[model samples]
Target: MMRWRSRSVSFFALVILVGGCTAAHSGEPSSEQPAAADVVKVSTPDTSPRPNDPGLDAKLAPVVSSAVALAEIPAAVVFVVTPSGSWAEAYGTRAFAGTDPVTVDDRFRVGSVTKTMVATVVLQLVEQGKLSLSDKVSKFYPEFPDGEEITIEQLLDMRSGLFSYTEDVSFNETLDDNPGYVWKPAELLAIATSHSPYFEPGNGFRYSNTNTVLVASIAQQVTGETLGDLLQERIFEPLGLHETSFPADGDHTMPVPSPRGYLYGTNVSALQTVQLPDAQLQAARTGALFPHDVTELDPSWIWAAGGVISTAADLATYARALVDGHLLTHEIDRLRIESLGQLDETNPATIRYGLGWMSFGPMIGHDGAIPGFQTFMGREPASGTTIVVFCTMRDSPTGVRPANEIAKNVFRALHEN
Candidate 1:
């Protein structure tokens, strides 16, 4: 879901917000490592009231409201659970011009957040001895350039130098021309391989969706099952994530209780630049121009890389389990935590990317963005604090990731409290 060529602006904003965290650590996953006490037992959301700090709502409500208004997002849901207490709130409306308010339970297309689930399944396969991180890409698809040199770990960590199909000009054109086209995984890979890789495999880092698509394909090849089926068996079922689902190909519908996703510009326009013309920006800000509702656009184009649908509650639960060793064995979880490396070595405060997840400040998780929706999910492993944000709009006219912006402000508010 990351557009490598245009990711700098958004990534810079993230770095500024989370740069105060610890320097990146380096290591590989080893079975000999001892279990870390930071692991916590996973629990479902409590319906009963829990102790909460009175000052939290006062500090956070304005952050969400101001961000939503400034970013021109149609709606958003922010949920935070800390050692002190929990706060969940929804803002704006379900549609650009609708009067219905969005609720915290409404579902959203979580974009690249789906990568974490696919990565979890891949790690589970490694745990089951069906896969190895060192396995070369050529082991499955022998045609890829330097496939022999690319490891599964590289793909999981965004170190794969594969070209991202999403960045291809034709791919974006197709998305704009045929929003309903059902994209197959092979088609996506073909588009990526048609172009030369950004660099030799394992030599550098680039956020390529092609890497994740390949990982999902490999998982399917090894298990002789679809990615959706594997996720259902390994993650959704075990974690009791009833609100989450990977949509079947050709199914462009969102489940009920979901808001319409809005976008200000076309895919090509966004690819060229996230910023809108001055006149358009002014009109949009004044509500004279409304964003197009793209809620039903076929998501198959992103496939296993960015095609999961879930609500804030499910994301909160999944984020906790992802970092707390609930889904994988403690040994693998420790390795995952220790695998984090600075995305930009030059910036010490740069957010670190690990095995399919990221560390920003005290939280470890991922953020996602597609055409009409944006999401952020993270949990502080030590304190068991979790934050989930979902914005109905993909990005602001100024190219800001609305969900991440709000999440960053919320994180600041949490630390202050």
Candidate 2:
């Protein structure tokens, strides 16, 4: 449910990608990985989605096609399911600057969607009597200013009113210059706290990466373990997601045989200005400037806020668990639902941001985006349906909004049919 505030003004008819090392990390799945028998077979998409009518594949294709066409997205993958059946499709390529076609198993950055996982882990701790929703930030990070005023609930609701450090013009400038710069939790908080609060804590709503960062830090402190470890112990292992991992460093290269991500950049010369494609955009940003491994993003930068990488199948599997109460007991589920109530009024009602996931009509989940990728997934618990979509290359010539539009359109189409 986190929306991007930035927009592109100038459009490049064609773009180029700068190639080099990828900055992302990968780790071995623990012994707790789920059994193969539990993993459901993800069916290939055969029919297009229908809007008002059911039993029509052509109708569904147009909706998805128009959305992709309008967005001019370089690459996209979509999967949807309902009581009747499931369908998944891959469109475009992994990198338009190159000839690599996108496959069903390609991995993509989940951006803020990682927040849902972090929130779920934290809530699980609460259910285990290891953490408390009412706990104050002061309990974990006594150094943070006004920690007492910021409760766990406020942080989850984004009602903490803490100004976002991402909005700092200087931060953006530095980020542009040193795309690989590593960030620390304290540094990120200082940037955020330096600004005034958007409103009183627990009052109005404003989205800030700071809230999730704090949540991540707090979760680690309370559990005496890395967020990644906690996730494996509870969710990933239980679900048996082979492709999901949280690289603390910002390494961009996927493990051996992983799909390559291409970033589009502007190149100008006397002869002509053209877009270039670089497979190493992620590595350059994380390894070179950040001085951190690509596999593990500075845990502090995204903290619990946005550092998560997952496959489309894994994303759908996780969403199904979250919505169906496989992860949260009924008592704790109520708290999570309550946390989503504080979202900004501008977002759609279908999008009621709960503790971690966003509710869109019957669909409940979150979406993620970074510089080169966009991801989203949701589940309709009542109908036992799950939808997961992923796209490579962020902010193309057309724009990034199409990804968002696709999520909504897909949800509506599924419901109507």
Candidate 3:
């Protein structure tokens, strides 16, 4: 289902591949393994803050730290990068149920940020002449209804008006009944397609995870490789990312020396505070009992939408690579073309969506949230600076706005410095 007309109130809140093509390493066997020494305690400010470094530390550190502390979020990670260099800082305990400290390298779900990578991979195929933007969805999947009417460009641009399954109440009911269930790609789609189109294709804009899932499936079919494999071949290997992966199974554990993630609730709507509706709580509570505290959401549920995980360094590199023409220049152009369709009619100063990303003036990127994670990656293209923030806690009501805002301040501070 693809629905792209949702309002800012709907979005209101709220990356890289590794080389070698190996299956992702499984979560650590024991919970008791000693935490790595390099995992910074996150209390102290970065010692050698770079000269042009946006002094993001000086600008938003207090604000972000206060939010994380006030909300009782288990862990938070901030990363800042420019043409000159990059640095990562960590804060809070790794485990909410215990005393372990959070680490920088830990893997949390990147959520919709995964769309950027998925879009990149698709654009790569387009560049190689394997696919074309004008191609219709029916070209790849004949069974898809109204495929001929829905062009690949529309899908990439979020102009496809299919109903998002995420809005399905029945699907939410089933998810509530089985919080630990691992969803397959087809299964997830079936839920969304069960509903009719939200609006005529190409008439409006909505943020639909299903559009990304479909893209991933199509890419796999055309390339005859898993999305993970393609990412390694096209993006990760060239970039030299040592710690990124698409876990085939539902494991969410980052290796030792990484921050642990904590999921606050079950529903996609309002923040799932510590209140009841608590049966879904046990599987989540596993993060407390196990040392890795890994999660079990089937990667297929997110597919291209929110699947992969990586470190702050890798994310910054990927963002820089995207802007530097390392990825497809034309597709990047397509991404930058502002979608007046999704703009807030009430506030002209507010943003409209872009292909797999968003634009705030000259600053362009996207922010994402899953149960236990919130992340943002943005770049001021003309200035040649990129900012990224990742955290383990998804705040109630507030979402990841703090990390996103901190990233903005970080960039401004660095620019001013």
TM-score of each: 0.86, 0.75, 0.75
State the RMSD for candidate 1.
10.3
Choose the strongest candidate by lDDT: 1
1 or 2, which is superior by TM-score? 1
**What does the lDDT come to for candidate 2?**
0.61
- What RMSD does each model have against the real structure? 10.3, 11.5, 10.8
Name the candidate, 1 or 2, with the larger lDDT value.
1
Ranking by lDDT: 1, 2, 3
Candidate 2 to truth, TM: 0.75
Q: In model 1, which regions exceed 4 Å deviation?
A: 1-53, 342-349
Candidate 1 residue lDDT tens string, 1-417: 223343233343333223311111011222232123211234655522233357767777887678778777788998887767778888888888799999888999999999999999899888878789999976876545567788999999999889899999889999888899987776777678667778877788899999998888888766656677778778887678888999987889999899999888888888878877999988988888888788888998998889999988888889877887788888888889888843332221247788988887667889999998999998877668788999998888778998888887777766663
Ordered by TM-score, highest first, the candidates read 1, 2, 3
**Residue range with the least summed lDDT across 10 consecutive positions in model 2:** 12-21
**Positional deviation of 353 in candidate 3, in angstroms?**
2.1
